[model samples]
Target: VEPKITLTDKELQAEISELCKYAALLDDSQLEVQVKDGVAVLNGRVASSYQKSYADLLAYRAGAKEVDSRGINVHWRHTNPLLRAQRYEKVTDEDIQAAIQRAFKHDPRLLSFEPQVKVEHGVVTLTGDVGHLTAQQAAEQDALHTIGVQRVKNNLRVRWPDEPASDEQIADYTRAAMTRDPYVERHNLNIECENAHVSLYGVVDTQFEKYHAEWIASRQKGVVHVNDYLAVRTKWKPKSDAAIEADLKDKLAYAFVDPDNQVTAKVENGVAILQGTVDTWYMWQTALDQAIAAGAREPHCLIEVRYGLPSGPHYYGPHDYVPR
Candidate 1:
C-alpha cells in the first residue's frame, strides 16, 4: 500500500486563511478558522448565504479533509455601505413591454412566436400561440428577467399543426433526439407519450442530464409538454469528503471570472450544499453547473447576489431561461 499524505493542523489553517483573503464574498475580519486532524471548522457571521458557502469552499481547497460549517450564521441584511445604499428602481410598464419584445426578437428560439405582452403593476400577461411548449416557456422567461417585473401570467397556447404527429411518432422522435444529443445519450431513460405530451422516467448522474432530457423532448416534432420524473443517480465511488470538496473547489476557481466573488461547497452522501456570493447572476449559474459536474447529485444553493452593483444578479421569472 502507498503512504497516505496528510496535512498538519497548522498548515491547513494557514492555507485556509490565505484562501479567505482572496475570496471576494468572505468577510475575513468576522471569520475564525480552526483545523484539527485535517478537518476544518469555520466560525463566523456572514452577511449573506453566499459568504457562508464561500468560507467552506476555501477551507476544503486549502487541504482540509472534512468541513463543518454549522458555526456560520447568515444575516440577510448587510452593514456594508455599498450594499446598504443599493436601491430598487421602479421600471415603467412600457419599458418592461419593450424589453420583452426585444428579448423575443433576439432569441432565435422565440422569434417564430409573436406573443402579445401586457404589463399591469409589474405583472406581465403573455397571450399568443406558439408551435412548441418550449417557445411558450421562453417568452415567459423573457418577461421575468425584465427589470421591475414581479410576476408573469403565461397564457400562451401551443397550437399543434393540423397534421400533428401521432403519439407513437412523437415518442420515437423524442428518443431519437435524446440519443443524438451526446450529453443525454448515455443515460437509460424511459419515454412515454400520450396526446403528444411526453413523460420521462429514469436515473441520470447530473441535473444537467435530467433537464437536457426534457429539453430534447420539448423540441421534438409534436411534443406538447414534457413531464420530467427523472432522478439523479451518482455512480458509487470511494471518495473522501475532503477529496470531493477539493475537486469542486478547483473546478469553480478555474472557471470563475471574479477573484473577489467567493463560493463554498460541502458534500455529504453525494449531495452538495453551495453557499456564497457571486459578482453576477451568470456566475451564480456557472457555479451551480460546476458543482453538478463535480459529482454533486443535488446541490442546495444558498448563494446570494449583491444587487445594485455593476455585476449583480439578474431577475429570473417563473420559467428558467433556455438558450438557443
Candidate 2:
C-alpha cells in the first residue's frame, strides 16, 4: 500500500478557498479564509446562517480539524446575484391535475398502478392501490412537490402481497436493512413490530436520519404502518428564532437571481413557517429546504407554485426515477 499523504494546513486552506469560490451558495468575494494548525477560520458577511454552516461543512470535508465561523456576519439587505427573473403567469386546477397524472405515469414505482389524481383549487387527492408503503408515500411526495399543488390528500392504500412474513421476521429484516443503510446509525435504535405495524424508537443526529429509519422499516416484508418515535438530537447549539429566520431569508435570496421579496419566512417555537409564492416547484421546495438548514424543526410550507408561461423552451417530461 502507498503511504498515506496528509494535507498540510496551507494545502487545506487553499482547497477550501477554491471550493468556496466555486460554491453556488457562497459569495467568495466577501469571504476571508485562514487556516492554522488544521483549524479553519472564516470571516465574511453572508446572507444566511445556512451559508455559514455550509462553509463549516466544506472546511471539514477539506480535512480541517475545526472551524471557527464567529467572524462571519449575516447581511440580508442585498439581493442574490443568481436570482431568476420573476414570472407572472396563471396556473389552473386542470394544469395541476394534468401535471400529477403525467408524473404518475412516468414514475417507475407508479407505472403498474394508475393512481387516480384529482385537483380542486390546487388541492390534489390521490386514490388508488400501491404495492408498498414506500410507494404510497412516494406518490404523496410527488404530488406535494408538484407546481400549483396547495395540499395533498393521500388516500392510496398499500396492498400487501398475500404471502406475509411473521412480525419477528419483519423486525429482524428491518434491523438488518437499517444496519446496511449508510445514513442510519444503529446506536440506541429500537425496532418493534406488531401485526405488521412497525414502531421505531431511537435517537438520531438529524431529521433525515429519523425519516430514513422510518422509510427503511416501511419497506420491509410485512410492514403495514410505521410509527416513528425517533427524536433528532443535533450536535450543535440551538439557535434563536431570529437567527433561524435570518438564515432562511438569506438562503432563499441566494437561490434566486433577485431577492424574492414575495417569499417570507418566520420561526415560531422552533418550527419554521414559510409563506410565499414562487414561479416554479423548484423555488417552493428551496424555501422549505432552507428553513430546515436554518435549524428549524418540521418546517411548515405554505408556499404556492404558479407555473409561468415559458419564456424559453420548457418541458414536463420525467427523468429516470431512482427509488433510493
lDDT of candidate model 1 versus the reference: 0.68
In model 2, the runs with Cα more than 4 Å from the true position are 1-89, 236-324
Give the per-residue lDDT of model 1 (tens digit) for 1-324.
Answer: 322225689977876765553333442225778988878898877788877886776576555678898988778654454432231133467766766675575456786679999989878999979999889878887667555577999999888777888777887788788889999787655566776777775556688888888888888887778878666655656666677778899997888657678888889876677778765444655666676568765566566655322111232322121111
Model 2 per-residue lDDT tens digits across residues 1-324 = 332226787887877775564443564235788998888899977888888887786666566778899998876754344431111025568766765665564456676787898888878899988888888887887677455667899999877658887777877788789888888854445565667777765446678898889988888877778978665655444788889888887887777655443677788777777776777544554565566677876566666546521111242322111112
Worst 10 residues of 1 by lDDT: 315-324
lDDT of each: 0.68, 0.68
How much is the lDDT of residue 102 in candidate 1? 59
Relative to the true structure, candidate 1 has a C-alpha RMSD (angstroms) of 23.9
Which candidate has the top score in lDDT? Answer: 1
Per-model root-mean-square deviation over C-alphas? 23.9, 21.4
